[model samples]
Target: MSRTLLAPRSWPLAVKVPLVVAALMAALGVLASWLVLANLADIQERNLRRLADVTLGTLAASLAAPVERRDIWETFDALDRLTATDSGMPAVAMVVLLPGGEVLAASDPRRFPTLRRLDEPLLRAALRAGDMLFDTSRARAVATYRLEEGGEQLGTLLAELDIGALLAERRRATVALVVSNSFLTLVMAGVGYALVRRMLGPLSRLAVAAERLERGEDPGELLEPPQGSREFRKLFGRFRAMARAVQERETILKRLAEEDRLAQLGRLASAMAHEVNNPLAGLLTVVDTLRRRGEDDGVRRHAVELLERGLLGIRNVVGAMLVAYKEDREAPGLTRRAIDDLRYLVQHEVARKRLELVWTNRLPPVLPVDGGAVRQALLNLLLNACGASPVGGKVVFEAVAEDGVCRFLIADQGPGLPADMAAILERSGPPTTPPGRGLGLWTAATLWQRIGGTIRVERVPGKGTRIRLAVPVRVRAEVV
Candidate 1:
């Protein structure tokens, strides 16, 4: 029961609320039934006792003369009149006794064949109406009264009431109580079920909406408008807001992922240009040597061999480029040559924009870093800075290595980061940029983070934006 109540998905609000209400109603019904039955029995017993007192008091008054005069015929005649007057009374037998405690006459001799001596308990217990002794378990009330005339004791009267009619009435009352309580429980259950279902209907719809959102389906109609109380409407509003936020985050992640892929492709192109250009330059040098000194066979043979090797190297570079597009390749560690190659590849873009590219490289050779990927990330940041800079504007590119970490910064002579971008950077989390901004910066941030690094954006002096890219050479432990 506890587990069921705790896991709301298993037992939804629609079912739980009604179950609770039904439980309360059932408890109330049991209590009410107990009280009703008990009170009814008490009332029946009190009414039976009152009837006995009244009937016995009147019979004793009429029997005083007959009992005192010791006339058996008159006493029996009065007993017959008493029974005939009210047949409904539980009066089965009547007897008259003398002051000496001797039974003088009995209305039914068979019921009291041994009534020569009257019962002393019944005689002693006749105090008042409320004090009448009644044996309710046996459905019997024996009332004994001392007959008197002008304060003089005449004789005694003993009446034995049957009490069967009172018992039957009590049984009927019990049946009626059972029927009424059963009806009330059913009514309560129906009303509770209806009210609970009505109250929680909106929540049910909200659950459906949430499930659809989880499945990446639009919750168009489900979140149209909320009904019911103000609290529920407010709750609906909050749910809609939360869902919208999740949707927006998902969109940002998708766009950032695509941008990252595009940035990698761009890197491959740049690296290919650098690789192919070197072999082409070598082939050109070999051709010039052969053209100038073709008379020497040895020189010609050496030049031909060098030319063939350079051409083969270019073929291998092109093949590697095709393979890189088809599958992932091992990442090479950063080196001076790789940095120089990247600088050479981006010179065309910088010259086209006529921007001053302040390239600073301060790092030892053979740094333990993913060269191609880091180059891509750095290239993206540099490209964005150059694009954002005005003509003849300076794009500062700086790189350094220290303490098993690489630090790279790119500052552009353009307006600082946009307001929205600044807000995103101020909130510390995984780097994310909204749509329609610079895809290059978004790609750089994602690539840096994927390699277990952090990216920070700063507003440089003179209305330019400075972006920092940091990557660890190797993971290390830290003391808590």
Candidate 2:
């Protein structure tokens, strides 16, 4: 069995397309923002490291002179001024630790919300250790570290660069991100929505055209186009071409099918006319003979029987052909009267040909379908089976419902199908040659899909070939 997933009829491309695009865009924006945040933090860390190296170098050189306490202050203050005043990026917030771990001088001491002096564990570790550079968060951003000392290892000295400026940088980056993203999102959304809406118009028009075609009108007759797009017009053009090709193929096939039907009807008509003409002539002769010389009861009786049999044959032939050919163009339906009637019709035909008829009562009376089309499909199958049979051949039709689906099985002892016919019917083109048959298996498949059914073909081991059709059931109570 085959399963088909259909899009909901009420779904609107206008709303759906924009929403999907927006979600995708938003995800991209978040990823970009995270990268920017990480990169900005890295740049800030590098700037502070450069400042620490410069401050520590000058302090190390000053260590050669005999220590002057006041000059120590002056040395620290001057160096801080130099870095603070000319920092390409606000590089000022820094603190200097003396030999005894005292806060000798500073740059913006208040920038630190909570200041623990040189006594702090991280600061003490940096000052006590010999000259070294490291990273520590005196603040929520990157801060540089190094020992403040002269080359001659005096008591360890430490200085740390401040990180308050990084917050300002973060704010700036945020503002830029918001402004840039807002502008770009609006521009992209406007362009994307327009593109989507334009693309959708062609599909909508195609649907309308399909409906018109189903009603037996030429869709291309009016040929008004949908709003076109820069990229999608080509797509729609291809779609239109494909639709036209399908319609053309369908038209040709339909003409061929109709011609075949007509030819079959003609054969039946000729047979009936011939049969009726002979019986009428015989009846006329018998009546004339009776009129001339008193009727022979036995001869009259025989003539009457022949006349009745011939008339009955003509009636039966006409009735079958008429039922098979009648078209049902309105809404598809399942009629109780038709199913019961065809079952009997098929039984008689099979009996007349001396073929065995095997049937199972698994088919529910209530199945959603076109009763007439179903009958025609079955009739075609039975006709093929009967014609293919040698005297005393067997044919079987069975139905079973399982897993919320109906399976139809038809088997016959007819000549096993040719490879060519199997390929077209089963569409599993074998590596060998295919058989040619006048009946249209492709049409049967098309009709099956139209009514939400499926067809599969396979060979029955010793019985010849088997055809399987899976159709969905429709209940009358549900329709009511």
Best by lDDT: 1
lDDT of 1 by residue, 113-190 (tens): 433765545434643342546666877777666688889887767777777777787788778877777777778777
TM-score of 1: 0.51
After TM-score superposition, the amount by which residue 477's alpha carbon in candidate 2 deviates from its true location, in angstroms, is 18
Q: Which 10 consecutive positions of candidate 1 have the poorest summed lDDT? A: 320-329
In candidate 1 the C-alpha lDDT for residue 11 amounts to: 86
TM-score of each: 0.51, 0.60
Which stretches in model 1 have alpha-carbon errors above 4 Å? 1-10, 33-39, 66-77, 84-88, 96-104, 114-130, 133-137, 149-156, 227-234, 260-480
| Candidate 2: stretches off by over 4 Å | 1-119, 128-162, 196-217, 221-245, 270-318, 326-354, 358-369, 397-409, 419-436, 440-452, 470-480
lDDT of each: 0.71, 0.58
- Give the top-scoring candidate (TM-score): 2
